[model samples]
Target: MKLIAKSMLVMGMVMSLTACKKESKLNPIPTSLISDASAYDSPDRIATLVNGLYATFKGSGFFGTQYIYYSEARSGDFISTNLNPTRGGLTYQMTVDPGISDVSAVWTQGYQIINACNVFISSMEEKGIKVLTPQIANNYLAEARFLRGLSYYYLLQLYAEPFTKNNGQGKGLPLRLTPNKGLAEYNLARSSVAEVYKQIITDLDYAEANLPANYSSAALNTTRAHVNTVISAKTNVYLSMGDYANVIKEADKIVPATAPFVAPTGVKNALQTEVTAIFKAPYTTTESVFSMPFSNTDVPGTSLANAYLPDGANATGLGSAGTGDFYLFEGGIVSDPLWKTTDKRRALVFTTIAGGNKGRQWSTKYATGSPYTDYVPVIRYAEVLLNLAEALANVNGVDSRSLALLNAVRQRADQTTTLTASSQPELISKIIHERHIEFLGEGIRNADLMRLKLSVPAKTPLGSSPVPQINPENPNYLWPIPNTESLYNKDI
Candidate 1:
């Protein structure tokens, strides 16, 4: 059933991509057209659709690859050295134009998943599958809702201005709660960030309330949405919303009283003692909250190795991340830090200059084994701890608990030293620094700056010092609504 469902999901999304075409000569009908009755009336198909939704989430267009890479590159974590600059979002080469392919792919692919969730949710509620128990059905609904909320979160971050930037009134994604139905459904205008966030909170709130504590099946465990999974996502949402108190409230649900802090959902997550092992395969670190895994057989088409590591860079024969475009800094905090040169986090990526390239220090985090398999970590427990510490500092002006959380993450990276912050602002600064170093290649830098309303201090391969900052007031900070969307949606 899993295999068949996985295959169908790939086909399902492929068709969705085809449907996104602006113009075509042929009038090809969809290959599989199961009506609401055919899909939802059966318990088996309903179960399969739930898994299929995950397949959509796992797609390269989403979390499987592009989402992570684009976020990292655009956030100024790495400078693009490639001549053409393929991934425009990473280097700020693309314009705030409606027709840009890179930005359009993100919009189209995100809505594909969003619409898939809408279909599953509507069918389950309207048609009713008799074979499953009530608890099972509710869990499925919770999972669908979580994914919907998650999809919107990513879209908003990329396409809309930061919620905190203009008091949440910026043009946001079209808040489509129902299953898509042809051009009519597609032709809608943007919602305000505040409005979209309200919907996201509503969906996630239900997910947190009804989702199970955990699942026994390894496949069904952390990969699926449980209460803690929902909480982890909600913490992220609140953090993005700049609701620091709510961020603390949501994070507290997962954070532990001490080290080896296992979540209430039975996820035994903590700051990994060894920094390098965090990105390795089978990805069950003491710190992973939610991760999307891919093996050799079922790969995220844009594998991180292929996107970050250059050719001949990996002697492991696994894969490459890009054509040597992704370059890191030797003098920056990423490699040789101004504060702590002995930090294990810096040492991990700089090991062998990230598989030995001539003019660049790259990342080896994704270049795992032969055949190059690794997982995309959607959220980590370490981030939650950092969020908690930052929130505490923001709320109470740097207390013992906040400082301890900061020290815990930093010390976990390098046990020989502990960090100190005399004031709330100092502690918040330390917490942000910890996040940057801790999640170096993991792609949180862009979002961190967005929520803080700070200008992106960008650099280029050709230039020496930083480029003019991409400011908070600029439209380039957010991607434009696609030409496809504007062509169809009159309100756009």
Candidate 2:
């Protein structure tokens, strides 16, 4: 989602006044403020705010810009190159001090979007608008909360370390619930990770209660919001925190009554399913529970797809330097056969540029021509099933059902070998491994490694040929808070 820049702010003012319904009595604007709750009162007026929230998912300010890339960059997916560039390599990995550009951008951007959501939520009641109703106001408040929770989820992950058994015992990003009035109040201290997670859960619960089951195709493809996606995302947050019990509880709410992990028609395949469709464009599929919708309207074709495209491909007609600049996965060289050829993930997840040459086809999944408009799946039915399997395997042992779920995914990927049985440790490890492969470019690696307490050591094919050991204590594990937040809040 893109941040509402000053340019956008002006547009918002223009849009609200023109589209706002007659019933919306403009609230008295504060002297210093140019806009506020009054900006989103009537159905037409509040619609503009939805685009602002969607903007948070795009651009350089927040997750879409750098934070999302940070997760994949540190992982095996991409190496920095001339065409595909990443600051992390220049700063965090290679040098003594890296600039705070990427990480800080995400931090500041997320909070900015959160404040936007809060503005909408705080005004919903005062505006006497039915923003939560179907069609009337399109359930704006619920969507806002979901977006808010997702922002916090990313913030907590980036600013704070993974939660321990004590549940957020360590400091977390400062909780900012309301829209700021440009006050000079002291920023709150970092809350415990547990407290942050609690807030996230609370926000998601409210979102689920008010959101609808699914969106129509028109809504799905456009900037519009729906209810089911929020619920699916909540399932993801619970899984990340290792709250497997809640994972199962939340997933059950959306999964079809008969099918274990099927999403509704348009959103089906949100579950991990058939091998081929998994790889093709419409990059995100039916299985997606919640997705970050993208549009050419903001990012255009060259933004994301170009970065992941192979070097010198027809797809990249007017190639940008971002294309084929990074290594797709570490196992690009013959010496680093990290993945097996027979493993369907090899094809579905990656491609070789220039006819399968080493390092050439590595970043194939994200090509220049890939419609640039496919909503990136932040959470899908597949993850929910995997979460349930992991939780059940950890707590109840890898029984028949658990093994079935695990194998179901592997089978779809056409893995030659099948696991008969394994202990909890083995099962959990396998589950995570599947997640790593399944979600390679989608940005879930660091969180998986952190939560699992696994070493950040690189594998032979991907990292240093001998593999570099990534100690957890390394500052790279947790991204630095943005300078803006540090300047504003003392929590850093």
Candidate 3:
């Protein structure tokens, strides 16, 4: 996990905001600063602070890299050839111990981003900013709040029980809403899951009302917290909360059914065609709703492809399976009849001996650049469609609408073989299947198991199955809160 080492004082004292990689090349996080009075003296300085928020997102701890690695390793999507994913090796399968470096990094880095967001949010509220930069400050405040709420949303999923489990009354991360003014604020206690969700919803609600609806720049629209990002984030939060109604409500903004799906800001948020093309390389499509940007000069320490591909000396891919660390369970979607023939998705996986791993199957999604520059997709338009489909299936059972949505995704990879299911349960099953294939190796698998209350099927990294069953209720399923917070925060 990566953390920007900027304090609130650093935020205000900044003279220039480093331009992001969206428009041009991305440079490393800039550490330039002056003093608060001079910083906020101009509206441009405050704008730079807002850019700093995305800078945090670019950190390796957040979307820059490890977060995706942690999520996928824990999830069933990819089994590791190495025993310990935390160490340079692969996962030991959700280590019972909380001291896993990667896990700890995730916690520490997550909080770092949270703290950064808090500082931005609280700093924007200063009365001086109201007089000098009300509009810019409000815009940035909403953006910061949206990003902060999204961070908490991710943390709650990994650290707390699913909201559906106990109506969200269970243990949640400690609420650190205000800026960390001093060491005294570090002692805060954990908030209830419902409380966290409420705060998340509150922040996002404001973001929806205030954040710019559209940006002409794809970099700003997809990489920054615009209306689409907020909508995507809200969909994820509600889905995790088991609030199907709201999931549909948020997803509806991006699903484009018969009409062109657009963000609440009136920006076109629909998926781009050519499923393989969308992910084969970086910045491939408009389908990417929200993603973290990385450039050659400022690449995250480890690219997402590191463990998945045994090539790219710059990649941290640990791929060592002759067949695949994750294999088709057999007689199912992985072995779909079309896979042997026309399925374009199947082509992305190929066998090769590289990086000391022989006959390992690797996904080409991250093979774009020598060092693997594929951007991390935090939210995709396809996920929105699937979320909406799942919500509708659960709400109205199997219907034409849900079927159409599910089929649309299914047909994306291979239009020749459109799929269908007989009931709501069947349709939901299809949606899950589609996600596994659609998001393979992207880090969505394990979390899906936890939220859907599904079991993790043990398997060799070679894609062989029938290892064992990890019940969804296992405590290991929920990552432990890092000692960084628990040990320091007495309330935790």
Candidate 4:
């Protein structure tokens, strides 16, 4: 696949590759250029390139904010209160076009990360062993592959058809593996969805074998990819592909067979005692398998906080402040009676009364004020458990282990209410509903809807206009391939 260096420059990779640095465990900025000519000259330079991949992944255009907002808003979980087009109004209304900035920005940033990973992987394979030990070199290569695989998975969720549809015999993104440097690489065609999933699994398999079992600190364990991280990601990928057997197989690597289901070997990840604690100060809990960490110095601009939190006057004692661009939809999962008011997860939603309206709820999940420093969760242990539960129920109908896994997540938040299902379909229904409640404001809804080939649910109009339900057959069901790609990559 070919992309012009000019396109890479426009994606901000030229600057991010050389200068972007976030302070944390992955510290120590480098002053060298991250070019093919000199990027692998020293050990620190190689490490800086790795960190740069993460920086680009966590940028606002991707995971930093827009991705999460796009996923949830499009699922009808959140209604646009402000209807600000720049802030995801088009996404909420299912009106995104190829030229839309959000669509283009996400695609551009995704490819930027993928290309950086390819460059880093190639450089490491060719020259990294010269500076670093073989063991360390392979570990770094695995990390690059892990990021590359994850980027492709995320892009497919929005831009391509679901793998469950006709066994992934649908158009997918360009499977760009080699480093795209010039115009010569600009005419690559899209691959099949099954082909993309094959590549994603290949990358993740290598990562599970070569990536470290655990890191030194809790922060590194939570923020960086480890053995269990790769396993957790594979479970998600397999589940999306309707490969339930593989989901169970991959999940079994980390999740135990009994209660207190902590990963026994690498990164003792388990559900937090309290659901909200995972989102609090120093958000590096074991439950957080992988997340995009942020700090006051390096924040997710105009992303989480600004998109979710209500204004100060409206928030009152919600203990947060922001522009309050979106509110929990009255017709969303929040309205489900099964999601009890006393449920601990309900604490994340707060009620605000205004303009004679009785109870308008706003999310306090990303509660930080101005700079929105909340670490965005990429995958959590709870999700892995649910994935395993759903897969088990599919493979073995109404099984005890599957029910146990389902209740593990449910009873954690709402101890008073235990879920029960008599048959396989019933059990799966409960598990799906549990996901909607458990992952609210965390950006899992739309992906769940898509992977299962479910319709984007109809939303009730509040401050903004009503959005109709979008079935799988609708043209707007999937985000269009960005115009930038269409213009540059003729084969697309």
Candidate 5:
């Protein structure tokens, strides 16, 4: 039951020599292979391992596509047009099991990333420090820890129960900190969710302390983990735990105390005047706090565009052409009256009027055609703002700062609207609704529902495939530990 697949082991070995230099900042050329004895002998080789860690983290099975797709599809947002299990049709219907390919792939790839990080960190501790400057070595170490924490956090979200359940006393992931280099390291049991979160926070805290506050370029700022990036990620992780107080504390480290909430210290991350601008070319906006960048050469093949965009050429010319795997359900968040037609965010949705796909509406957020090189957004400044707002409302009860934070996101897309709530619950509800509208296709809905201990809302039937409402008590509410893990890891 080796968690590191033979293929991934080869990938990990090759990555040490020839990393994916998707951008000039992460350039790694094909050099002759080096054995374990000399793998961490030079600064350049160590740096290539850092870039390679990101490449693995952004694999199509992880953040590059399937993870986002699975998260959104499990929610009530999109209607599955394809019943192909290979394409996540079972996930859309909330029928994902240990045997589902996508489920198994996510589990396998996620651990691959975690193990890669462990190996990188262990190697650096053993040898990299002697070759690279202490500061450089620590920075690389922080990056690996940050990625490992993030991987565990996401895996916990889908594979385990909500952290809010009994204060994270539920079953969580195997807390594998050391490198899993061979067959003997595969029998570990799941940690309590609390223990896993403790490690996530520990890893992120180190990352925040060691990671650079900013990068030399915008691409690096968005793609690489910086101090603010670690802070932003902490805010998300805390919010998921229902730890509102800590969410506000972490968010405040980067977000301002006042309006026009640009990060004063780091990348100056603030919302774009136009929501669509963040999704357009150059995809390096301040609002894009962290994302998986893809170049024409290193694309997320058959990814977001293939799953969310329309199958043919779009009528509006926004997303151009897509595979049309799923469409906006007539009953999804788009149908809310609060989501006014005047809202600029509406442009992300394109309605088909005359074709086999007629009457169907598609999300054009990941609009890039063919090669599907859209940068997959993992966390955004806007999410930090919203997380702060939610925390504030919960902690202070209809506070002014909460109202302002909520309005900042709302008015950005729909200027004509100004939201107000008389009670704390109402304000919280409004904030949740705003999230649904703001992050419709960016993969926040399902996590939101899960964190709040809410049921997965029923989706409108597309022909005979009717997706039912999944309550929190249902076994299907949380994806099972994939057979890939269960069959191998005896502890399960």
Candidate 6:
């Protein structure tokens, strides 16, 4: 029954894509048409439709470019490197648009996905499918909530200001649960960031309560649906809320390290323990709570070959027809030796390419299969440790555990010696800086910068001198609602 509903949904989406004729511009999602109650009566079909909800979040065109990579890349962590100089300037504008294009894409895609999930949940409830127990049904809802919360989290960062509410209150994207049928719903105004966060917490709590401990099957666990990803996501939310204690608590729920730390094995670039293993693609190491796996077949442009395939570079094995996935430091800024040499993060994520590639040296970290095989990992275990360390230090200042966590990451990168102990404030500042360096391209830096109430120093590498700063006082931090939405809705 679930399968049938899923097929129908896929068919429906495909038809819509076909009618729009924009399917080629983006990856085609498997959609079906389950229009009436008669088709939904079967429990199996209902389950299938629920399953299709996961596909909506997969690497579609808009999702791949806007949500996963471009959004994070445009933030201060990375400078624009062009594979095709003539046409790449606009791509570089992502950094200056203040994430407008990325934010708009996220707003559209997230709401589309949320409506799908809500529809599935509603449909499943209507069907008396004892197929999954109540706990299981709730678990599905939790996953939906988790994804919705995540979308909102991104929106808050890109569109709203720093969290200033006493209990997480501030203007945030409108809370849209059901699909809007007309202009009335579109007439709503922005809610506070605090209000948005409360919903995020509510969704995460629901997910935590009903999700399973772990799933053995990689496809089912990592791809289909499982608990770890949701937990990892929850940890991210905790960090965003400045709730360090909860970050530690939620991360532990995923990987309970009975021992202090374990060394990484197998892969040459592996991290120290099973927990760290999640960072790598192979060996479903105990650490990965939630990661969007990119297969040569599953995702549209996440392969290494596609990402790294130079604009005119040959297609080595699979044919010379793919585009490069990884972006090198082309602005001459990403190569600053001080941070580049001392901080091993550059080496870890980007592969150094020589010969003035597109006006400056370039490298590749994603795009394993050439022209696009790069898998986009949303949440990993390493982040958990960093979050824990940062949170621990923030909550209680620099301590042994925080030091240990920070050292573990530094050691993994084969970077400089460990940081000496410092005051709570000093340690917090250091941790924040390290995190910015460590997670340069992963999309969390802008939020961290805003949350800490700190300013970006005028630097040449990624940001220019007199850095474009954002805080509660800066209207620029709060992106203008897309002009299209503004025209459609009178609230603006």
lDDT scores of the candidates, listed in order: 0.70, 0.56, 0.65, 0.83, 0.82, 0.52
| lDDT of candidate model 4 versus the reference | 0.83
Q: Which candidate model has the greater TM-score, 1 or 6?
A: 1
**What's the true lDDT of residue 268 in model 5?**
94
TM-score of each: 0.88, 0.80, 0.84, 0.93, 0.92, 0.76
* Native-to-model Cα distance after best TM-score fit, residue 202 in candidate 4, in Å: 0.4
Error of 2 at 277 (Å): 2.9
Off by over 4 Å in 3: 1-37, 85-92, 131-133, 257-265, 280-284, 312-341, 353-359, 461-468
TM-score of the candidate numbered 3? Answer: 0.84
| Colliding pairs, model 4 | 2-185, 2-186
Range of the 10 consecutive residues with the lowest summed lDDT in candidate 5? 1-10
Tens-digit per-residue lDDT, 399-433, candidate 3? 77877877777777778877787888888888877
For candidate 2, the 10 contiguous residues with the lowest summed lDDT are 25-34
Expressed as tens digits, the lDDT of each residue in 46-117 for candidate 2 is 556666666654545554536656666665546555422244453224222224566555665676677667
Candidate scoring better on TM-score of 1 and 4: 4
Per-residue CA lDDT of candidate 5, range 302-337, in tens? Answer: 589888877665454453777677888888888899
Question: Which residue runs does candidate 6 get wrong by more than 4 Å?
Answer: 1-39, 59-63, 81-103, 128-131, 164-167, 181-184, 252-283, 301-354, 358-363, 455-472
Query: After aligning candidate 5 to the native by TM-score, how far in Å is the CA of 388 from where it should be?
Result: 0.2
Q: Rank the candidates by lDDT, best first.
A: 4, 5, 1, 3, 2, 6
TM-score of 4: 0.93
Alpha-carbon error at 72 in model 3, in Å?
0.9
Error of 2 at 345 (Å): 2.8
